[model samples]
Target: MKYFFAIIYIITTVAINAQETHKRTLKLMGSRFDITVVANNKTEADTYIDIAVTEISRIEKLISSWDENSQTSKINRNAGIKAVHVDKELFDLIERAIQISKLTDGAFDISYASMDRIWKFDGSVTKMPTPENIKASVAKVGYQHIILDKEKQTVFLKIKGMKIGFGAIGKGYAADKAKQLLKQKGVQAGIINASGDMNTWGTQTNGDQWKVGITNPMNKNNVFALLPISERAVVTSGNYEKYIMINGKRYSHIIDPRTGYPSSGIVSVSVFAPSAELADALATSVFVMGKDVGLNFINQLKGIECIIVDEKGKIVHSTNIDIQDKLKNE
Candidate 1:
């Protein structure tokens, strides 16, 4: 199995010949969600798409840290005071995030929300932050400080201001849940794209595989390759749009939780995995780990492949990926 982060934002799904593919674009979870499904009739497609929208909304209510009434907000409100009991679904998600944190050695941390906004990429700051300021920014970021009580189904933060936010992994998790809900309802094929976090199952109406175009980071308009996929998740994390160039160095919006510094050297990291949730978090982790370390880590994982584009626009893939056949014919 091969995987890559294609320029999904610029390419829409296409079908060969005439086919009935119903699609709806909506704003959900604070991102552009394009939900497409293949069905024999419009009513069936609309109904199934509604089910997906409802499922994704339910997840947002349970995990959104920004909403005061959400369980996640409640967990943050009581930080350093007491453990807040939560629903089984939210609890399990947090538990899995903690496990990923350990796997990446704090590079992928949910506690990153507590980081201070000392560095800005809005073209505001002219000089790099002082060493002391950078050190102080991540004072509250440590995955070990998050205490999860499995028996009580509660979450506790060891510090008063420490918080957990799913900005990096939430959309992918939402996409995965939505896809599972649709499949359970007997929907044969569809694509759930939560911003750039996408999940697909089955083929198109014409029986052709789903084609995803990989965008060249150096030349954004040109697609370097086209990857055919089915029943898998593809997530791309890149700093190309959100970054600041200072003294000829490009600093991305993705920050390294370990150092409180913006990740540099890599422009984009696309991950392919069994689920969008894992792919989303791992893609961000690869950005922080850089090319050598990131490629090695991805190669060791089973059923996970990644494509990393370095600062110089050179493309690198995991050990299993071969570009001979994946390059787009067009």
Candidate 2:
């Protein structure tokens, strides 16, 4: 009888240990935040995600120019006249943005915000803009005009009234930073899914990798592909966010810095890269680059891949996409 009781106790201990798991999810930074940490104890993982949320929120404030008193707005207000020193994280992100602009030949410009909102996404814009309007809009859209004084750690928009904002890459950078914080906190496996911009690491409970679904452009209710992912980031950009109708044609909110016009041709573009920052910037660049240019640009990029859907509803994927066989779409 004693031996039988001891065996039952041993089995109970094993079952309890097997049931151990941890996950945390919340609304933060105007987006969804999800965290999964695999450990023998749930308390430790929960504590780590809490710490990560606080750190990421601090960064959002520093870089969010939309906030009335953010550090970036203060810098934009001062412009070239005075340099406002920022924390290293903000400074580094801006610096990297400039590099991406140069690499993509201004396709991924941060200074594109300097252009006025004459190209409204509302239904009121019934016709295309005149040549004069197009020319004037791009006058301040040059990426080269974004001035960064490395010595002083200040970001200056050289053109007066020009602005710099991270509407494109902010979420991705935040996700990347948050993932780093989690890894530093000893999280062995997890995902930080910021909206649709997700950064994943390690494997699932069954030893399989994270499976990410690519939404079908033609049918929002269906997924066209199920890609297995691990230790990577994916971000999607599309006209679904905002648009306008002109001459019975839909124009996306994304503008081309070169043409001073809202972009079209591609309905959506999702990029996968080693870090969320790259995925963020690439998604925006690909949207502005249009279908052909965007596809070529992604192909040339190392440590990166993409899934691009054209306005005609045709899907194009990077040569390297690793989709699973179990659920191949028709």
Report per-prediction Cα RMSD to one decimal: 3.5, 9.9
Q: Please name the candidate that would achieve the greatest lDDT relative to the true structure.
A: 1
> Mind sharing the TM-score for model 1?
0.93
lDDT of 1 at 164: 91
Worst 10 residues of 1 by lDDT: 1-10
lDDT of 2 by residue, 95-213 (tens): 99989989888878877767777787667778888989998987877778777788888777777777787877777788888888888877777777776677888766556666777
The top-ranked prediction according to TM-score is 1
Q: Candidate 1's residue-wise lDDT over 105-175, tens digit each? A: 98899989989999887899778899899999999899899999999999999998998999888989999
Worst 10 residues of 2 by lDDT: 1-10
Candidate 2: segments with Cα more than 4 A from true spot: 1-22, 326-330
Model 1 ranges off by over 4 Å: 1-6, 9-19, 322-330
TM-score of each: 0.93, 0.88
